[model samples]
Target chain A: MHQKRRKRADERRAEILAAAESVFAERGYRAGSLAAIAEAVGISKQTLLHHFPTKEHLLVAVLERRDLHNLGIVADMGLTIEAMARLVDLNLDWRGLVHSYTVLSAESVAEDHPAHEFFTTRYDRSRHALADSLRAQHGDRLPGGLTPDQAAPLIIAVNDGLQLQWLLNSRDVAIGELFRAFLATVVKGEPPAST
Target chain B: MHQKRRKRADERRAEILAAAESVFAERGYRAGSLAAIAEAVGISKQTLLHHFPTKEHLLVAVLERRDLHNLGIVADMGLTIEAMARLVDLNLDWRGLVHSYTVLSAESVAEDHPAHEFFTTRYDRSRHALADSLRAQHGDRLPGGLTPDQAAPLIIAVNDGLQLQWLLNSRDVAIGELFRAFLATVVKGEPPAST
Candidate 1:
């Protein structure tokens, strides 16, 4: 009976999150209210509070859900440069997911935000994972002095920097092409001497 | 008489914007309120509204002030890849400026945001200027097929992407090194060959 109750509670939480995401995306994070989100989910604000306690809590849950989904994709897949590239491509394909969260995450920088630690830690974990992957694949091919730690940040930085441009004007830019160039640069183990 | 009134009005407007920026930075966009900003400026909400009609207008004014400052920097500078690199370096050096504006800009994506057009146009102008600079510097040096338009977005993307990591874990990452590496790759003008 306890397990069944927990399952139902979890399902309800997921429903709330889905509704919140839609509302947040449409209204932008700041304009979105707990009452509106609860309304969308056909729940009372009191019930929403029972589940999330605060809007920040709900926002963090949404981000966590996304992180879990992305991490799962990376974890379950085979390790290869191609796989890494594909993972990034998947992120690009879900531009809306990236766009919505990025906007919210940026807005989450205040002293009281619940998602602050989550975003900070999320970035750290992503850097470590991507770096670890690079170390594993190209342990033998690093340029004269480059280490996995150095390469990892570069990789992460490029991935992130690309997303900003994608958000601004995905209409004109090919995110995949840029990622491919970055991957090739990494594989070659040196900055290209010339284009 | 007109000049005196306009001068006082501009001074008041600047004062309000300074207060608003502080409040917005402290509280995040959504949570920050016009009343709070007015209080910070030691003015009534009526006075604040007299200077700037709405919260969105005040926010856009703050962003415009920053962009104008940046544009001033860009204008006094000559066209060259080296100048572009220096501009990137300058931006990273004033990392707080980038962090504050980016955090704020992300929150300014609401459908009715007064700053939405400003942010969009600012991005467009920056990309165009950077692309033009690259083309001027390396017109013939680019790999046979790559154009500045193609390369400019990639550079902008990397710069923006690195900001997310920088904002998250400033201690573990050196944004400058990664940017330098990227600039080197761009200056070289060739796509990295596959291993």
Candidate 2:
């Protein structure tokens, strides 16, 4: 009975966080509120607070959920260019998530923003992890004189920039194909031949 | 007397727009207000309204002003790789403008955003102009079988993406040098030789 009750509480918390993600994505963190999140989850603010306690805590939870999701996808696919292409393919199915990530990241560039620490730390962690992973996998054999360290940031930048363009005009930009070509250039030390 | 009054009005309008740019840069467009802009320009909100009747109108004028400034710089610099590097160098002196542009562009991705039409049109115009200028200058000689058209978006993406990374970690990311190297990779079809 205790296990059953604990599972129910965990499920309710997840639902609240999910609602918070949508509200924050649509209205932005500064404009988003617990009241709106609670309404979306069909719960009272007090109940929502029972799970998150504060807006900042809820925002952190949402970001942590996304990080875990993203890391899982990458790990499942292996740390290859193919993995990145797959990520882009996945992005197409969830434009909301992409928008949330992009908006929060741009907003987080301000030093005082609540998400600043989250994103700065995120980039640092991702860049170093990717660099080390690439080194362990490919060593110095990568193309274009790109050390794993160099490729790490460039790859992350392209992933992000392409999403911005793609979100603006999805019909014109082929996110997966473009990312694949970028990866090919890195692997071959030259731009891929036009198809 | 009429001529003098008209010139003064124009000067005040310009001043107000400049202040708006700074405010929107420091706080996002949605969070920025006419009162703040007026305070920045040492004018009354009533006077600000005389120049730009609505917040959207002021936002549009601010964007147009920036567009004009950017066009003037690129025209003077001749649209070469060096020109792009020069732009990056220029960015170092105006972190606020860079932050404003980055934040606004990301926000403008939403269809209902006030800057939506402005940014969508801006990208279309820029992409076409860059493609045409590149073609006229480089002909079909671009590396990797890339037409000027193909390279335009990629270059723009890299430019915008690099700004984001640099903004987040200015001390570590050498924006101008990194851009120069990106240009060299395009020019030579390979990474530039180490100096």
DockQ of each: 0.40, 0.55
Q: Tell me how far the alpha carbon of residue A148 in candidate 1 is from the true structure, in angstroms, after superposition.
A: 3.7
- Worst ten in a row by lDDT for model 2 chain A: A186-195
Residue B4 of model 2: what lDDT? 100
Error of 1 at A146 (Å): 6.0
lDDT of 1 at A144: 24
Q: Show the lowest summed lDDT stretch of 10 residues, model 1 chain A.
A: A186-195
Residues B1-195 of candidate 1: C-alpha lDDT, one tens digit per residue: 999999998898888878887787666566679999999988999999998888878877888787777667667777555555666667766655566676766654544555667766777777798778778867843442346765676677667767767766678767776666556545563332322
Q: Stretches of candidate 1 above 4 Å error?
A: A1-7, A27-31, A92-95, A140-147, A186-195, B1-6, B92-96, B109-112, B140-146, B189-195
lDDT of 2 by residue, B66-179 (tens): 777777888898877777788889889888888988888887887888988888888777778888887888786476446576667777787788888888888877777766
Candidate 1, residue A107: the lDDT equals: 57
User: Best-fitting candidate, measured by lDDT?
Assistant: 2
